[model samples]
Every structure is written in structure tokens, then in C-alpha cells.
Target: MARPVPAGTARADDITAKARIRNAALELFARDGVEGTSLRAVAAAAGVTVGLIVHHYGTKEALREAVELAIVERFADAIASVPLDSRPAGRIAAARDEAVADMLAASPAIVDYLRRALLDGGGEQGDLVSRLSQLSAQQVHDLRAAGVASTNHTVGEQVLTIMVRQFGRLFLQPLVDRISHEFPEDIDPSRTPPRLTVELALDASRADDRD
Candidate 1:
């Protein structure tokens, strides 16, 4: 149940219109690659004029960049749910898991976008991957600092492995689901650290925190 916008809300520079355009582009881009989608298609999906899209975003490439930015923000916001500073390890672990679970559940389009971006590959897309890896490194460093991450794995190793596993979910997970005959808890490691990496540390961190 969404709240209605007020009367006289100008279409130009309206947050709603921008968000609508962003979401529409995300969906269309995920379903049909950026090459296949058109400004008119995005405008139609967003229920706004093609002229309005051009006015707001200028071009399809600009619109794609906007969608990429929104996707990064979603991942960042999920990480932000548990600040990396001196929070309790138990709380951080729970919050991290909850945040990622919520993000994956909510952002199927984002997952699809990630799949396309990672597979397609480009300079800008490479930047997106680098940012995502940096986010993973942040979590690994903090979890280790909090004494919740394994000491055995180097931070670089952990970061690399985490990125591989999370992106693997984007491609292999469908086959995994088919073979396993069950859905995953739907945690996107791209959005959070892998469950096993942190779970193994939970008891140790809780013990260390009490000492």
C-alpha cells in the first residue's frame, strides 16, 4: 500500500519520477540487455514520456549508469545495516545476515542485473566489481577484527573467495536449486559475507566479547 503523491507534484525533478525511471530501467535492462532496451521502452515501462527520460537522464547510457548507481547503493545500504565499527560481534553477525537476506529477497532485479553485468564485463562494469570487492573486504576486515572471522584465511584470499562464491550464486544457483530440490536462504555474498565465514566465528566472538 503505497502512499499517494500530493497534487501539483511536478514531473520534472520529482523524486518519484526519477525512482520510477530508475526501477523501470533496472527491470528492462535485466530482462533485455542494455543493447536490446530503448529509451522509448524505458519511458513506457516508467509510465513517463520519452522526452521526460531524455530530459532527466539524457541518454540510454546515462540511464544505465543511473541503474548501476542504484544497484551499488542497494549493496552499500545492506552493508550499512551493520556498521563496521566496534559493535558487538553477535549483533553484527545477525544484522549482516538479516540485511543480506532482506536485500536478496527484495531485489531479484538486482540479482539479475549483477548476473548480466558480471558476465558481460566492461571497464565501468569492472569498476562495479571492484567496488563490490571493496565492500566484501570491509566486512572481512571488520569480522576478523571483531574476532568473528577465521584467522586461517588471509584477507585477500577471503575477499577473492567471497567474490567468487557470491557471483557463483548468480550463475550456478539455478542449477544448484534444481539439483538440491530446495531454495537457498537467498543470501547474496556480494551484499554480505558468506554465512559459513561468519558462522564459524560467532561462538568464538561471543566468547571473546565476554572476556
Candidate 2:
């Protein structure tokens, strides 16, 4: 009873459909672990047919990789905004806070996604590690320029330690309750603000520079 759609119109519709599926998958993958989400679920969430999801992303792993790419791209953009030319510790701290805040505000789902990845050790862990390494190198460069304490440990180590602590307190642990559940004896989230932790770390790093 319905007339056939034109070739151009059908192609455009297909593109729109694919985009919707990808966006919906990103949200689901960010909130729920990839292993927990299925293609039918993604298709239903996106208001598309399961066939469309397969047409756009042939497999669940491909869909997840796309989601990871989007998340990492957004995070990297935020981090790139950090001022590299300023005093090291101050700049690194400010940049870190900005990136965290941006992630919290712009992509709250990503915090959950990151928490899952960090705790479960799944989905682009290598990419996350690489990014942290790069950020740590940046921090070391900043610290040296700012006259903060010089350390014999490699920048990668310093960055990994700082990143793990910061992410654990601010993002990962709070998102999933992993730390609280695993270590009840540890500091509770209600007892301390994350900013205080950052301040303490910043102060310790710059202790020698102070009068």
C-alpha cells in the first residue's frame, strides 16, 4: 500500500538510522558494561531494527571500540585545553581539575564507563594507560619548569600513581563502590572532599618551592 522511497531518500534515512544506533549504543555502553549489553538491547534503545545495528557495527566488540574512541576523544580534547606553558604543578593541577570537571559535566556517563574499565580491567585499558602516561609526562615537565621536587622515579610512575589515586577517589570508586566494598577500612567518600586530596598532593609536590 505504501510507495517505495527514492534511492537518495533511503540512503539518507539509513545514515540517520546508523547515527542514532551509534549514539544510543554509546550511552548504553557508557552506563552498562559492554559484556552486559546485547545487540538487541542497543537496537531497541536506539529505536532501530537489530539488522541496522549489525549493518553499522558488525559485532559487539566493534560497537564497544567505537564507544571507547568517542569517550577517549572527548577526554583528550578536555586535557589538551590544559595550559602547558604555565608553572608546572599549578598548571597540571588546574588542567587536571578542568579535565575532570569537564568529564563530570559533559559526560557523566563516561565516569561510570571509566570506573567499569578500571575496576573490571576491560575495554581499552591500554589506551587509558597510554593517555595517563602522556599526562604524567606533561606533569613532570611542568614540575621541573615550576621548580618542584625532582624525582628519580620515571614520569610514568609518578603519573600512574597520581592518576590512580585521583581517579580512585574522584571517579572510579565513587561510581561503582568498588573501593568501599573492597576496603571498608579505607577512608569513606563522605568523610573527605576530593579537592582536599588534590590540594594536599599539590602542596607536597611544591613543598621545597615554598618559603
Candidate 3:
């Protein structure tokens, strides 16, 4: 007796199912950690059959890898868009902020996924962080090459500092949300945070001008 593989009529042409499965998996994985989520759950959320998910992604682990890869690629694109070579060091921040804001606006689920992945430190999360670190290192190298960053300092140390500060914002978010709500309508505690401290200062400056 021949055993059957789970593969069915699914084809490379099943773009709709593939896209739906990826989105649904990303959403569910964000809400529930990858360990807590299952192919059945993903299929239910995606409104597809487990067999179809298998036909497209082969396994839960593979699907998770795909999701992580997608996130990393998108973030790389966002970071790469910054004019690191052309902009003055101080002016680089504004461009980076705009790129990040746009990225978050397009994919709101990213915040949750990042929080979960970073906290859990499981599966491809380490790889995701590694890829991000590589991107950050590249940014630092570019800044140094442009004579904007500390040329005499250790670039590795600088990269570590940048990584820590970025992760700190996400890891210490409880304090951030509690304190950053005076102008509730103008601020969003839920979205991936921007430089609220700087933004608040800008608001204060605007208020002073009006007064």
C-alpha cells in the first residue's frame, strides 16, 4: 500500500491561498506565540483547510520562517530607505523616523509580533534579531564612512549601543505607555512607539510659540 503525501491540488498558482495563509498566520502568531499556535488554528483564521496550508507551506515551522523572513525583509527595506550617505548625522533621524512611521502604519501587527518574538526568544526570533543587527551594523558602518559617526570609536560597540536602545524602547514599553498619555488624542500608546520624548518637546515648543 502506498502512503499519500498531504499535498493536494495546491499549485504555485494558488496565490490567494498562499497570501491568505501568510497573513492569517502572521496575525495569529502575533496574538498567540508560535508555540501556542497550530496549523489548525492558522487554517481556521485563514479560512482554509489544513491540507491546503500544508500544500503551500509544508509545515508550521516553515510557515513561521516565511513570516519571519517577510518581517525582516520589510524592516530592511524601511531602514535602507534612509539617506544615510547624503544626510547630515543629526538630520538622519527625521528621515529614519518617517520611514519607520510609514512601515508601522502599513503593518500594525508587527509591533505585537516583535514583542512576542523578542520576549520568547524562540524559533527564528534569534535569526530575526541577528538579521536586524546586521542591518544596524551596516547603518553604523555607513555613518562612519560618511564621517557622521565617531570614526575613532569601536563600530561594534556603537552597534551594540544602538541595538540596546532600540530594544529597550520595546522591552520597557509599560513605563512608556504609563507616562506618555497627557495628550491622548495626539499620541498613540499602542502603536510601535516613535521618539515620544522628542515629539513631546516639539509640542511644548509649539505651545510656547502660540502663547
Candidate 4:
């Protein structure tokens, strides 16, 4: 038998219910894709009434938008959490550690959602790509201003380089894991590095100041 909710907890329960619906939708959408998922199915998966799902989000598209915003906010928060003054390697180590921690705690559905969103080439995907590219370019600008990164490459090139390095893990983890499986765990480069990560910046001091 289920326990009854205490009196005066309706607001809290409502909040919980909304979150549950959102999470359930994310999982289902990742598995079934947005075109294949339905509100009734999401409500059933979330243990809520279909009416409640509608009450929280007017439509499935709204719910998906909410999920997309949450994902983008999470990535922004992760980047913002690192300090600007830290050494390049230290900053990367902190960001990497935070990312690993998030990965461990995050639902696999989130990863699936991102993969689907990018691969499906949804209309919003262009915006997502643009945002990430701008962010990468900003990071390159900061690093170069601080004398940590090379200025040999243009901002566009820097963005592309960083994006490839950053997003590659998300898109190609399975391939990397398979190829690295034969290697001993002790020296497997796929594994997270020690706390003090090596500097990824090129030696700007020696490079020509072209860009």
C-alpha cells in the first residue's frame, strides 16, 4: 500500500511531480525519439496522470525545450565553475574532474539526448552548435590573452580544434573504449588523468604572433 502525503505538502509534491515528468520524458525521448514518444506514455512512465503532464508543460515540444535548456545550462555551469586565474592544466583538471563526476551521476538518457539531437540535425541544433562554437572561441581568446594558448590559429580554427577535442569524447567514446580495451588499465590513455592534468596549450612563447 502507498503512504498518503502529509497535509500542506501539495506544492512540494507538485514540484516533484513536474521534475519526474521531465526526467521520464527525457529518458523516453532518448529511447524512442521525440516523434515516437507520446504524452500518455510519458505520463505512464512518470507515474503521473496525462492531465498533470499537460498542466506542467502545454505540449511535448515545450517539455523537450525545457530539457534542452537544462542540458545547455549544465554545460555552462560546468565551464563557469572553473577559475579564470588557475593554470591552464589546473583549470582543465578541475573541469575534467567535474565532468567525470557529472557523468557518473547523470542519467545515461542525457547523453543519448545529446547524441540524438546532434545526429538528427534538428532545427535547434544549429543554435546549439553556434553557442558551443562561440564558447570555445571565447575560451581560446581568454587563454591567448593570458599567454597560455597559441595565437597562430584564427579564432575559427581555435574553435574547431577545441570543439573536436571536447566533443569527441561524447561522440566517440565507444570506439575509443573498444580500441583501448586491449591495453592495460594502468596506462590506458582513455582513463581520466591524474589530478594535475598536463597543459593542453601550445607553447605560445615560441610561436610566431601571427593570429
RMSD in order of candidates: 8.8, 9.2, 9.8, 7.2
Q: Where's the lowest-lDDT run of ten residues in candidate 2?
A: 1-10
Off by over 4 Å in 4: 1-15, 88-105, 123-127, 134-152, 179-211
Candidate 4 on 1-211: residue-level lDDT in tens?
Answer: 2122222222234448887777777777777898888888888877888999889999998998766665665566566566566545435634634564364235467678777877885456435566666666776777677765665767786666565555656677666656555665656476673332222344466333322
Instruction: Say what the RMSD of model 3 is.
Output: 9.8
**Candidate order by TM-score, highest to lowest?**
3, 1, 4, 2
**lDDT of each residue in 100-211, candidate 3, tens digit only:** 5577556656767888877777545367787777777787777777766664446565556565555565556556767666557777667765443222212343332100
The lDDT leader among the candidates is 1
Which numbered prediction scores highest in TM-score against the true structure?
A: 3
Misplaced by over 4 Å in model 1 are 1-15, 84-98, 123-126, 140-155, 180-211
Decoy 1 TM-score against native: 0.67
Between the candidate structures 2 and 3, which one is better when assessed by TM-score? 3
lDDT (10s digit) by residue, model 1, range 1-211:
1122222222244458877877788888887889988888878877888999989899998898888777767777787777756476556645665576567656777777788888886846346687787778888887787677766656776676556545555566566557544434554535643322221222443434311
> Looking at candidate 1, what is the lDDT of residue 115?
80
lDDT values of the candidates? 0.67, 0.60, 0.66, 0.63
Candidate 1 local lDDT, residue 106 = 69
Cα lDDT for residue 23, model 1? 79
Screening candidate 2 with a backbone cut-off below 3 angstroms (N, C-alpha, C), the clashing residue pairs are 88-142
